[model samples]
Target chain A: MTPRKTDFPLDQCRCHLETGPIVLVGSQWQTERNLMVMGWHMMLGFTPAHFGCLITAANHSHRLVRESRECTINIPTLELADAVVGVGNSDGDALDKFDAFGLTPASGKIVSAPLVEECYASFECRLVDDSQIDRHELFIWEIVKAHVDTSIDLPRTLHYRGHGRFMVAGDEIDRSADFRVQNL
Target chain B: MTPRKTDFPLDQCRCHLETGPIVLVGSQWQTERNLMVMGWHMMLGFTPAHFGCLITAANHSHRLVRESRECTINIPTLELADAVVGVGNSDGDALDKFDAFGLTPASGKIVSAPLVEECYASFECRLVDDSQIDRHELFIWEIVKAHVDTSIDLPRTLHYRGHGRFMVAGDEIDRSADFRVQNL
Candidate 1:
């Protein structure tokens, strides 16, 4: 059986990071021959599915964002939440995240973004629209490829709320097909 | 102790439904109400931040989309995944899901659609933009109010893939303040 991840204590983040998971979006610079990481990100669509990640104009990944435009959304499960969060603090401008974190980069089919093998779910997204994102450095892209490890029995996800806190998504909580308002 | 949700299954309907959740737009007639469950949802902004979900015209929630133009997005935890999916399955045009699925509705802070208490989180969304949706029904709204059960030790989320399969968001795999990646 695949071992369940347990290092991340995300309840602290959920109560703190009220927004969502702290993710890492990375891409390679054609000029630099390296990849950079990002923290500000969110899902865009499912039909022609995509992702929208907010990057500061100065972040190293921001440069790659312009260079590659395509990036990978690496979902850090329990084992990588800490390291994943660390990427938020580590600047790709100064340091290469892949070299510092020991993460392996895999080739993606739909987009130019490199997939992080250590993370369970990797989404390949390309540009779609960002009419309102100039001030915030926001870029929305369509998800071309999404792959998950079916071997892992339990479902897990990580979200970044604000600061140090990280929210952890636990196993299934199947409510009855018949919903009861009284329980609320 | 809160029970672990083992019965809920992951959905593969990401392409068709979008990667967002539904906000309860009010029903048109007393006989039946419309609710738009979106899939192109995201946790984008963080400071004074909110989430964004998409609703397509083809969706049964279209009536809820048209009449009230306001609704609540009750976050369904593992326990409520089945009901969420079921609501996604049964159309409001043909039936009253609130009654058919035994979903209890509560008044919203901003919208008219009832909020399901069974869900772990709830968000009230108001219609903002309709320009982007082409063949799909798109309603862009700001997440006003959000709620979650205080009892859950660890909060997990549901990721929609498409079809009936929904992946449960899991816990943290690792924690890193300064994350770095290396080209493998």
Candidate 2:
């Protein structure tokens, strides 16, 4: 099912990403566009909505994103589990992942990379720093735009446990009362 | 209940960490020790068992970790929710987190940091690189030793979603058949 997303706050992107769910990274360079399943990522800052992820030079999408200096971070729910596995197993160099996985690509407002329409949320990111790229294969990004299907409330996002296993995001427990107002 | 953990392979640390659970970072420097609740961490490499996390210098644990160059990454289950919240909300400078939170600290084999005995898994780490610490407040560590409770097939870990809400890890889905053997 395609989610109808609305513009979301860039700073609040951590609410979805910090949970450490497996994400589909979409990238484009000229005529080439590709999707790659990624799990090594983390939130870095709040003001610029900084995010960081490790993308090895071996992946085809790495070249596309590095050259374009742009990429889309999309969160796919449990419903897209099969496609997530398919995208991870196949080589993006030989096939178009969107077409092969039967997923729709929507144009990003701030980046050239296409967003996955079926994803629960998508963030347009521009490479902010390349210093660590060569040494650690890590890309630091500034999230310029975010789109979320707020209607879903809580998404059953997939979290990779490696070895072909995924743990689905489950029930939520709120302890806002226990937190310091400033900390929250 | 305290889990009886056994030595786990260092290279396979990503199996538990890649899923993005909220972890209790334990650190010690001389007589000073602290525990910080962290959600911003990711696995970077396999052979050296490299891991990275963003910890603002303002955090008391950051100072302790930086000074000692060692820390313990502990994965707490849902049962330790109250301690997790209490540890994150309270200041460690004036308070002894281990005593206040009623958690036991065990000596690590490879690091000076004490591991939380209540946690399902604890990884002893030593700072491997300090280049990004000043610029990004990121600490890159090499996990030298790991301990895990293999008795628990799947631990119901917590994933932070900001605003004091946590998403508990749910059911597991295995797609081993679909994955390429090498990828798996």
Candidate 3:
């Protein structure tokens, strides 16, 4: 077998860790509202709709989300990559991310957290379970409200590739027709 | 405001559901073993890593995972898109998915579950928390061992976009130089 076929142990290079979409998370607590870039998150449920995000204690949004128990998940397209990085670069406690990055924050219907207007889609989320927060720094949230820009069907989004690199969503392929089981 | 600028309600769309990487889940219990394509998963922690995946009760792998308390998460690149769709089309209850799909399953280090050799990376996981299984059909797993194909770096991965369409990962953009805060 060739070297590429051999099973190699992934000791310290956790490059595969960057497998999710790069998102801008919005949080609000009392008078403090902030936006921070997040890439480690996933959908947990379908019927009641659950979302999970990992926020280390050091991030400013972690405290804000804990106090408010609500937040908004904003999905931005490739066009807003720079802004995504900008929001992630600044500490929310240090500056108002909205004013610093020139991002327009719109009020969410269900959550007090602000949603980025330029993003293609937004989900207003409420903290469902924080049992693992103290131990894992993971927050489980339920999406109560959803909004999208229907005019643009599929806007390209950004995916983080560790160490400052990102991959853009591109060229969709549809293989649904080949499946034997119609519904999944 | 332009039509695209208007934030319309995504009542049924739920487009934000596609926020994470598409992974192939490997499950085995007794004589029953299966490979099912899954897109709903997230990273929960960094040290002593925790991973969460939502598997509906209807899927065959759900029962196997519960009985075995172990599974493997295989990350496939875009080169295996057709195989991904093929694995998702059939019912694992009827046949051995490994032979049916012509997939190679190698022994895992810490778990009984077998890893897909064709995948770029594989995680041997053991179920850690099942409290949310009955209520949310969610499984929280801790990765015991990790494997990656070191020969290939940054291979294009497939991201599900719901309704049969999939987005391909493309082009790397580095913004580390732009960030004022050096560490995140």
Candidate 4:
């Protein structure tokens, strides 16, 4: 295939960077609690449930996460798209994000960070590595506890596609029969 | 909402762990070259283009990456789903994966690893951090070079769901007009 040269536009080129589900990151530090919409988080491992998320130092939740070393990852469906956008648009440092966004924060079983009651699932994580924070702004954590909304039948999650673009999880295709490897 | 009790089956419960787009990782170590399907990778940063991909110690490519400290992340569209599945189904250690999967390995510009010519985009990465390898098997790298197929329009990438289940990226909805934050 003949390839053509493309301009590396920061805003558009970064779209490929977003592949994981967009989530609301809840963080608490001292008397302050905040929720920031994040699309740069991913599951890092299987057995121990390692999770990694990138939060730039400029974000308010980033400081809170660094101070408290704990956070809750809330998975919201398409119904909360507007709220997700609202949470992301505003600065957590400037106001009471929970009150402004009308988000219900419930206490987690393990972590002190509040989980969004509106979300269908929440993962309580504790910081496991911060060595790469200054360089890559990545916070590695282990999911100590998890909760899911059993009432939801099919959860439609949002995937970020740059420049205010989003894609909803679509139809499922089973290809298990095609694979020769049993467990990977 | 009343919640129902559910069992946490490692294999079943972990299905939700997969949220990112699946890519075929191309690696070269010594005289051996291989391709492996991976869904557990994430973009760590933009400038300098830091990336992290979780490769279980068990995967054949894991050793190769550790030795070579370089690899190419090949992004294939939905058209190559069967080949992606085929590459992941067999062991690369025992055979030449390129010929087995009919993948055209073009010489990479920066890394010794060959790029999949059929892929629309490929990133040449050099390992930056292996600190979490023993614990989480996460390899952190910086994308030194990138190539994209500018001619390809509307690239529909596949997202792995669980146990042979996949989700194709659907319609795109733009929400950039609503956001006030300039750069995230």
Candidate 5:
């Protein structure tokens, strides 16, 4: 690998950190359960705990999201990297992704939306507001509960680029110098 | 540093990417051109051209953005990372971040927003739509052009995890075992 590829480490890069698509599993209109890929997702905090995500107005997930007013944000394990694009490029409007991908869903204790069985961590949220932007919607919510699979405490991770490509997060680096570089 | 400290990447594991602020530096609202640090942000795609991002409602840049109807999504560099936090934390309601951060603004060709002086790359976007989500309004944009500092093709990047934390993007890894990964 070249120097750039060799130095590719997820822990060291800040931009790649919070920019991956995880499975957003939730029930649509309360009864229909759905899962869509969201690279626009991120956690707002740890204390009160919050997560924010952007959804397009044209997408089916947005419709489902609006009716239920609840959802689950799952952090994908390294192994789920390929699955991320697989699910994201495809749409809930056309296919039954759960059955197509052989993915499983389970109900969560914290929120009404179902969680992806394969994901490592799940955040159950109650809608904070329904804000609009041109064609996309921003759903800010308060995290009610966080679920983790102790088995996959540490999994390989993936960050989204744009289209269908994803960069798997690898390696960890150390900061020997402080903000001033000479401070260390 | 402990191994665990270097374990999960700040980019991938930092929960604060959602809350960080950014200044959308544009030509000028009255005297100048376009730009705005949209706190209302999110990612929309992965390839063909990897795309995703958010646009906030309350900033003055939003108006320039409406006039130009396009802006670049600049992932902050390490040096301006704090500016990201400062911009996000401070409201367009109170003060102008561009002046505060000392970031230079340059006019964009196809779009309206100006280029942030210290940013790594600017994804020039065209307005996809400006729809309201529910309460907080958002603008959906599709990036049409990308301007990068040719010297550095954006190897590392920055992310806002809400509040004051920012994470730079890490390296890219091809974890796909085979080309068929997409087909699966």
Candidate 6:
């Protein structure tokens, strides 16, 4: 089911990404478009909403994102498990993942890359640094805009554990009382 | 109780870390030793067992790791939740985290940095690239040796969310049958 999403605050992006769930990265350059499942990513900074992820040059989406200098980071829930697995296993070059996986593509506010409408959240990102691309295939991006389905209080996100295994985002433990105000 | 750990295969380190659990980073240089809770880390390579993490220079352990060029990435379970929060909230430079939190500091086989005996796993690491450190405060390290408690088939790891909240690692979904052999 496609979710009705609202604009999200850029600084609060860490709240959603820091936990590290497997994301479907959407990319497009002129006529070519693709989606790749990525797990190796981390929040770099909060103010500029910097995010870093490794996308090897071997992937079909690599060149598209490199040329476009933009992409969409979409957070899929447990319901999209099959699509996530399918996207990761198949090559994006030969397949139209959006059509094959039955996912809806929505136009982004800032980036040309399409966002997956079925996802719980989608962040439109622009590449901020390309220096590490040649050496590490790491793309540093600044999230320009974010859209989130805030209705889903606790989205059951998928976290990849390699070898075709995954761990679902589970019960929340609120330890706010234990934390220092400054730390929080 | 501290579980007895055996040497783990370096190539399969992704199985444990790719899931993106918050880890306790251990570092020591001369008389100064510190522990910092780190969530911004990712696997870079398998053969050389490369791992990349961001440690801003403001962190006390950052200087220790930078000077010594070594650190230990320790994976703690839900059992050590308080210790994890304590280490993160308090200043590492002023306090002995291991002693204060009642975590045993075991000597590493390869690196001078001590490993937390209470953790489910500990990987001794050596700094591989310092080029990004000055520019991004990103440290690239190669896992020299890894130790894991194989007895625990499933570890309840803590994934940090902002505002002192956490998501405990949950149920496993094994879709190995659905996966392509090469992709798996």
Q: Which structure among the candidates has the greatest lDDT?
A: 2
lDDT string for model 6 (B7-55, tens) is 9999999889988899999999999999999998888888898899999
Best by DockQ: 2
Per residue, candidate 6 scores C-alpha lDDT tens digits across A55-95 of 99999999999999999999998999999998988988898
Candidate 1 residue-wise lDDT, A1-184, digit = tens: 2232222221121111122344567687674424444444444443455556666676667777666767766666667754565565666667767777777777777676677778755666676776635744668776666665545644355544333444555544334334344211
Q: Which ten residues in a row have the lowest lDDT in candidate 5 chain A?
A: A1-10
Work out how many backbone clashes candidate 2 has: 0
lDDT of 2 by residue, B1-184 (tens): 7899999999999999999999999999999989999999999999999999999989999889999999999999999999999999999988999999999999999898999999999999999999999999999999999999989878999999999899999999999999999998
Quality of model 1 by C-alpha lDDT: 0.52
User: Could you tell me every candidate's TM-score relative to the true structure?
Assistant: 0.68, 0.99, 0.85, 0.85, 0.57, 0.99
Question: Would you list the clashing residue pairs of candidate 4?
Answer: A164-B175, A164-B176
Candidate 6 chain B, run of 10 with poorest lDDT: B41-50
- Relative to the unseen true structure, what is the Cα RMSD of model 1? 9.6
Cα deviation at A51, candidate 6, in Å, is 0.8
Stretches of candidate 1 exceeding 4 Å from the true structure: A1-23, A33-49, A56-58, A106-113, A120-123, A130-132, A135-138, A143-157, A160-184, B1-32, B135-137, B147-153, B161-163, B168-184
lDDT tens digits by residue: candidate 5, B132-182: 322233455566655554455333444333233333445554434433444
Report how far residue B33 has shifted in candidate 5, in Å: 6.8
Worst 10 residues of 2 chain A by lDDT: A1-10
> lDDT by residue for model 2 over A12-104, one digit each (tens)?
999999999999999999999999999999999999899999999999988999999999999999999999999999999899999999989
Higher-TM-score candidate among 2 and 3?
2
What's the ranking of the predictions by DockQ, best on top?
2, 6, 4, 3, 1, 5
lDDT of 3 by residue, A1-184 (tens): 0011111122211112223677889999999999999877876665466778888899999999998999988777777877888888778888999999888888787789998887766778899999878866889888777776555554577877655667777677787788664553
Worst 10 residues of 3 chain A by lDDT: A1-10
Alpha-carbon RMSD, candidate 6: 0.9
State the DockQ, from 0 to 1, for candidate 5: 0.13
* Per-prediction backbone clash count: 86, 0, 0, 2, 75, 0
Alpha-carbon deviation at A83 in model 5, angstroms: 5.3
